[model samples]
Every structure is written in C-alpha cells, then in structure tokens.
Target: MARKTLRIAMNGVTGRMGYRQHLVRSLLAIREEGGLDLGGGDVLWPEPVLVGRREHALKEIADRHGLTEVSTDLDAVLADDSIDIYFDAQVTAAREQALKSAIAAGKDIYTEKPTATGLGAAVELAQAARAAGIKHGVVQDKIFLPGLLKLKRLIDGGFFGQILSVRGEFGYWVFEGDWQEAQRPSWNYREQDGGGITVDMFPHWEYVLHELFGRVRTVQAHVTTHIPRRWDEKGKAYEATADDAAYGIFELDGGVVAQINSSWATRVNRDELVEFHVDGTEGSAVAGLRNCRIQHRATTPKPVWNPDLPATESFRDQWQEVPDNADFANGFRAQWELFLRHVALDEPYHWDLAAGARGVQLAELGLKAAAEGRRLDVPELAL
Candidate 1:
C-alpha cells in the first residue's frame, strides 16, 4: 500500500524544539524515500513541510534537508487546504493563539508542552479543538522514555506492589552570572516570556505522575529564584525574574504522595540524571535517563546500622540495570510517531489537549501555592 502523504505546516521550526522536529522530518523524508529504519514498522515516516520566520534560515533548513515546501507565513500555510496538520513548537505564550488559529482552519494539531500559558486558556483551547472535531495532542515525552517505560512496566506488573510514594531528583548547575556568558535561553529566566521552572518542568512531572501513579488531587509547592540575575550569550546581564528551582509535593487521587525537586542550580553528577525513585510496599525502583534499576525485599542489602560507613559502599549490589528490548525513539520523536499514528491511522493516542490542559492546571496550581503559601486542590483539572 502506498503511504498516505501528510502535508504539515510547522510553527517555530527555527527554535530548539523546531530544529528537533526538522531533524525528525529529515529522517522521515529519508524513510519516506526508503532509507534508515533502526527497525519497527513505518511509524516514524511523515511528509513534513517546514515553516518558520526568516526566509534565509527557512530556505537554508529546507535546502539542507532537500525539502522545498517551506513557508514564512503561518496563516497562509494554515489557509492552504492541502496541509493536513499544523505543528507547533513555538514559545508557550504563543501556543494558545497558534493552536486556536490552526483549529479554526480545521487542521489536526501537535505541539510542545504546557499547551497554553494558563489553565483557563488551556481549557478553552481544548474546548475549541474538541468543538472543531480536529485531533490534537501535546508532547508528553517522558512516558516514551526507555527508563521510565521500564519503570511503568514494573509498576503495571506489580513489581512495585502497593506503590507508596515517589521522589524525583532533576536539575543542573547553570553557568555563573559574572564569569561567563548566559547558559540558558534568555526567556527562561524571565517570567513575562513564559519562563520559570514551575511552568516548564511541573507539566512534565504531572504527566509522569498521571501515567505512573494517578491524577494529582492537590499540590503544595515552594518555588524560588535562587539566581537573581544572569548573563546572556553576549555577556549581557538581565534580572532573573522567574523561579530557577521549584519544590512541589503532590497528593495523588489514590493517596500516593510524590515530590518533585526541579532546579537549575545543582551540579550534574551523572549525565544529568533525570530520575524518579519510586518506593512501594514490595519493592523500590530508580529510573534514570539511561537505566532503570529495582530492589525488591529479596534483593535489598542487609544493613548493620553503621553510621560511619560510606554511602556508596552501603548497598552496592541492590540495584540492577534494566534490560533494553524495545527499539524506542527519544521521548519527543516517540510522541511525534504516536501523534502521526493518531492522526493518519486513527489509532488510539492518549496525550490529547485535555491531558495538556491537566499539565497547565498543575503548573498554575503549583505557582498559586508558591505565591500564596497554601495547598491548592486540583480535582477539577483532572482528565
């Protein structure tokens, strides 16, 4: 059977996530023309017509990838009847507007996280997409992660029986303010431009919790902007108005408690271990980016209560690296394939606009809690 051709118009195809989508498109083009397949069926291949600002950059990207269908005008691309989907990786503040326009144009949509800058906007966006009868999805990439996948399998298989709680450790030490140029994007430190760790990373943990444990019922958070100022790439200094780190404690629907510590001030110890250590009645699992290891009661080391003993030598053999059997794409690429399957084949895909709204909900609640110093209930936000 000839593969169905999907004409996609991408917004923010020149940004970081945009470049990622472009690379994926280039790979898809290779597969469409029949080249690389680290092997599964034809899930990854799609015809991506790139779109972005700046004719020179767009032309360079398209020419480099051998793609001719490139555009600078987003509305023009949306107006074209040939475009099957509207893809977005633009800044978060522009997401609702972009998706709103695309849905109005009657196109299926895929975009990066937080979907909307606020919960109200996110809810409206979801409603708009549903009313338009167009398929929609956001990039919930962590679920597709190999380590997280293994942890999910264990949780599903009851290896972690009677799951109790979860603790997530995620952060990296950004560059010093005075010594060097800016380490992160300028918008990241400014709250006005859809910046902050609370908005950026909580949505991620929200999906992770929803996927692994259950829906979050409430959130109690303490957010901080440790680095009051930062320098950009050109040594231009700017006041850091957004929180660089956030500590959130969540109450899941099933009484499962989870804590997430997100920061930009911690040093990277192990290739930046974005990990979750889940403790349950029967076992405990630690899932990092590269590996997922578990320790059951049967495998846990016996401790003689020596306070002087070094931490590294205490339980050396309790953890075992998970075996990798599935041929998986990076979290983003995996969601990209899933969204394509959802749109092209009408296959069941879970990460819809409602899920995206839930992410926004968590983020908003976390921020509210941080600002007001109170626990915020979030049952109304659950999907």
Candidate 2:
C-alpha cells in the first residue's frame, strides 16, 4: 500500500477565502485526516505549497500549519514538474492571468468561482484548459452545504411533489468603516477592482438553482449601489462604484420561478446568513446553512386574514425540523476531496471549467438584465 503525494501550488493563500476556507478548513483538514483514502490500499497525500506575494504571511501560514513548503515565485512553482495542481483564490481581477499561466505550465487547475470577471474571459480559460487536456474544477461549495444536502435528499426522496417556486434571502449588514470598520475588503465595493453583488453572488445562485431544481432560463435583475460612499481599511473614505444590492428573478427550466435578494446593506432576520424557501404541491421546506424545516401539505395550518388583530398563532412551531441523519463535513473540504479524487483517479467530475463558465455566464447575463431593465435569456455556454 503506497501513498501518492500530490503537490498543490496554493496561490493567494494570504487572502480571506484562500486562508480560511481552502487552507485551514479544507487542505489542512484533509492533511489532518491523513490524506484521502482511495480504497484498495491506496491513498492520496496533498502537499500544499503556500504561494503569495507576502512572504511573511505565507511563511506564517506554512509554519502555523506545519507545512514546510512556502514560495513567493509563482512562475518557479508552476515550472516545477512535480506540482500536480494549481489552486487560485485570488481577487477576481487577478484570477484569469494566473489561471492562464497555470494552464500554460500543464498543471491541473482548481479555482474559486466567477472563474473570471467576464464571460468571455471565463470562456477563454475553459477553452484553454480543454485545449491543454488538463483536469480543471471550480468551487461550487453551496451544493455541498448540509442544509442544501438535506434539501437535495428531500427532492430525491420525492418529498416535494411539483416544486412550484424558490425564494432565497442572502445577506447581512456590512459596516461602512465610518464608525465601525467595514468587515469586507474595500475592493469589494469598487467596480474597477471587479466588485459587484451580481458578479459575486449570482454565480452561486446559478449552480444552486440548476442543481436543485433546473437550469435558469431567464434572469431579470435590478442592481443598485445602496451606499454611495464607504470607508476603507486604512480609514480612508472612497466612492463605492459597485452595486451593493441585487434583486433578481430567475425562470427555471421546469416552469419554476426563483427569486433571490442579495445585499450587503440589509440586516439579517433569518437563522443563517443565507436561507432558501422552496414551495411545492406536496410539501414546503425552508433551509438555512445547516438546518431545514418542512411543512407537509396535509399538516399545513390554514389561517384567516385579519389585519386588525394581533397574531396569536405560533406559526413557526407547525413546521417539523429535519434531523441530521448523517455526519456532514465542511462544504469546502468536501468539494476539495472530490476534486482531488477526480485528479488522482480520473473520477467523473461535473463541475469542470465549462461549468464554471456557465456560472460566469449567469452573472454576466444578470448584469445585462439589470442594465437593460429587462429579462435576458440564459444561453448554454459551449465548451
């Protein structure tokens, strides 16, 4: 029983998503679990090389995680024949060029979503990967969420007969850094730096809707910059050029209507930062990040409309909570494991670069719909 070590060049390891989700939670967790078991006495070991511009931050991360490999030179790392994968979680504007370099070096690629800021750039990346004949994947972590997994289980078990519609509420108030320091990066509010609510979140909605219900056929979006100005990390004020809020209506393939509201300006009222409510003929379910509650049609309570009186019924108590029947791993880590197996074992992976391009297409179309003030049809992206 021999263990196969796969070297991964993890660029942008100093960034928020890169450092937290990919490095600490996913790769490090995988390492802590003694790598991935490939069955039949075979295992895959992931050797991560921290790659970023800040040598001090990279070294700190490497030392914290007990990883010996750390590098600031991406070209040198990519040039190495032993590096099997190149993972990028850098800012949106920097992703395309890095991916192109990785592809040129003939490395298997995995990256954070949006793939690129624009559809054309995303398509080019996908086509280049295809031309290079290399394995590529994007992070579609929502589908791996415990709540979404339970919802998927319900759909698979036919709990929802004729799903009618889906409503998604996602967002939380982000401080403006005037009195309270802004929680998000300043670049997130600047369009010149590839920042917009539509670009950031529509890609996530696209996959969630497509995977759970059906493909999104059309999109009508109203995107706006709720806050015209914001303070930066250095306590400097700047004009917010990007849209901070996006209200979208998506028409699905199976005659299902989906609506999602994404805004950093809105306050949270739900159990989690994101929540989805799906209504169907047989049953209706509301799922958050890790919890799902369902109300069957037979057990649904009927209420009379009375605007003059205070509500007396505890409506929330009627829905039954879905229990966690199985242990759930971190969503990001789960996807990483799948991608690793796909690379090592040549396993079938549906979330390839082409799929990532589709996500980018959705975001592009969503922005177009917002600008034109009309519904735009989503066309399939040819790989």
Candidate 3:
C-alpha cells in the first residue's frame, strides 16, 4: 500500500518548544517511525517544511534533522497548494496574524497554547477558522502526560470516588541571570512580550482542571512580580514587568475546588517541577509529570496531632507508586500523533481553537481576578 504524504508548514521552528518538542520529538519522530499507520493497508506520512525568518537557522535545523525542505518565506509556503497543515509555535503576540493568514489561505491549523495574547484575538481566530470550515487544534499537551493519564485512569476506574479537591504546586527557581543565564527566554519577563505566570500557566491549569475534574466556574487569584529585575540574554539588567508568580483558587463544576500555585521565584520541594494532589472520599493521588502515587482510604495511616514531638512516621512511605501498566509515549508526541490522525482521517478532535479560546479566557479572567482582589466568573465562550 502506498503511503499518503501530508505536507506541514511549521513556523517558529527556531524557538525552543517549536524546535525541540514539536519538530524533533514529535513530527520528526513520526517520520522516523515510518509515519503513522492509518490501518486498512494505508499510512499517513508527515513531511514538515521549516518556515521562519532566519534562513541560516532554518537551514541548520533542516540539516541537523535530515530534513530536505527549509523555507524562510512564510507567505509563499502558505500559498502552496501542497501543504495540508500550517502549524504555529510562534510567540503569543504574533500568533493571531499568522493564523489569520493561514485560515484565509484555506489551510488546516494547529498551534501552541494561549493561541493569542488576548482573549478577543483568540476568539476571533477561532471564529475565523470555523467560518473557513478548516480543521483547527491547540496543543493541550498536559492531558497526554503519563502521570495525568494515570490520574485519569484512576478517575475513570472509580478509584477516586466522590472527588473533592485538587491542589497543584508547580514551580522552580529560575536563575536571576546576573551570575547564571536564565533557563527561560528573557522575553518571559517582559509584559509587552506577553510574559506572565498567569498568561503562561493559567491556560494549562484551566484545561487540566476542566478536563480532569470539571469546567472552572469562578477564579480568585493573586499575581505578583516577585523578581522585579533580571538579566537578559546579553547579560544586561532589565526590569521584569511581568508577574513572576500567581496563586489561584478555582471553583470547578460539581463543587470541586482546585488551588494552583505557579511561580518562577520558588524552589522545587515536590517530586517534580509540577505536581497535583487530588483528594477524593475513597482515596488520594499525587501526580507529577511522569509518576503518580496513590493512598487508598483503607491504606491511609492515622496520626495523632502533636506539633511539639518529633515526627516519627514516614508520611511518604504510606503511599504506593502507581505501576506503569501501559506504554507511555512522549506527551507532546502523543498529542501530535492524535492531531495528525485527526487531520488525515477526519477524526473528532475536541481540543480546537474555541477550546483554546476558553483557556485564554481563563487566563484573562485570572489576571482580572488577581488585580481586582475578587472572584471572577468564567463565562462560556460563545464560539
């Protein structure tokens, strides 16, 4: 059986997430694995053409990855009739315009989250894609994480009976960039560049809580610019205007409450950089990026409250590690495969632009709730 080739125009392949996750780990990996088997003696092959402003960087990436196509001309690539999908992993502020152009050109779209810097722009993009009758998707990669998948399995298996509350602690101390270079991009510290913990992380939490538990109804948040100053890529001091940390309490449907703390100023004290503890009536589970530990009510230990005495019991030992009963693919790669199959086979994909718009709305409202010092209701997007 002959394999059908799907041409993909990938913009922002020069960036970190775009280069490492989307290009190398996902698309290229798919190609290396002899493309996706669509079954019934048919296969779908992905041929990605790197599109960016830097020809040198694009060429370098193409050469390094054994890719044959590299084009700096986005407009020309969009105009080409052969490209089936146009993917955008560009910066938040530039995403809307590029996506609009792609939609206008009658191309299916898949993009990284936030979708756009503002909710209005994100919704408008969603509406445009819908009006154009194009298949569109947003990267909600966290749902594909191994640990989260385990948590979902537990929830689905009725292990977590009568879900109550969720506590998420996500953060790590990013270097100040004075003595050491910052791990993240310097643009992440600038508000004008669409940088902030609320914008960056709330979208993630929004989908995570909504998909895992229920849609978020109300949000109360506190955002702070913990690190007022930071060094840039050039080792020059710059004022960090964006909020470095955000504390949020979300009220989900079904009376489930979720509290999430996201920060770049805090040090890691948890098992992973990000971890969520979900407590239910029957059991409790703590999930990080790759591992999950559960404590059933029957196995839960009882301890007398005594603050003065030295703690004797090993609290961490009470929980049992959840076994990896299933093979776990890379989170981003798994989502990429799903999206590819969706585009190729016309599979139902719920994580569309409108869903992404909801994520942006949550972030927008979270920032508002933080500024106003009050709980803000998350109204459903009309799209």
How would you encode candidate 3's per-residue C-alpha lDDT over 281-303 as one tens digit per residue?
99999999999999999998889
lDDT per model vs. reference: 0.82, 0.94, 0.93
Cand. 2 TM to true fold: 0.99
* Tens-digit lDDT track of model 2 for 1-383: 98999999999889889989998999888888888899899989999998989999999888888999999899999999999999999999999999999999999999998899989999999999999999999999999999999999999999999999999999999999999988899999999999988999999999999999999999999999999999999999999999999999999998999999999999988799999999999999999899999999999999999999999899889999999999999999999999999999999998888888888999899999999999999987777
All candidates: TM-score: 0.92, 0.99, 0.99
Candidate 2 whole-model C-alpha lDDT, 0 to 1: 0.94
Ten contiguous residues minimizing lDDT sum, candidate 1: 35-44
Per-candidate Cα RMSD to the true structure, in Å, reads 2.7, 0.8, 0.8
Return the TM-score for candidate 1, rounded to 2 decimals.
0.92
What tens digits encode model 1's per-residue C-alpha lDDT throughout 1-383? 24456777877777766785535543354555563332345433456777777888878877876778888888899999999989888778887888999999999998888898998889898999889999999888788888899998898898987888999999888875578655667788899999999999999999999988998998999999998978866678888999999999999977999998999988876533598989988899889875888889787776676688766563636687778878766677667766777887788987889999999899998999999999989877533
Candidate 1 clashes between residue pairs 3 or more apart in a chain or in different chains: 173-266, 182-232
**Which is the better candidate, 1 or 2, if ranked by lDDT?**
2
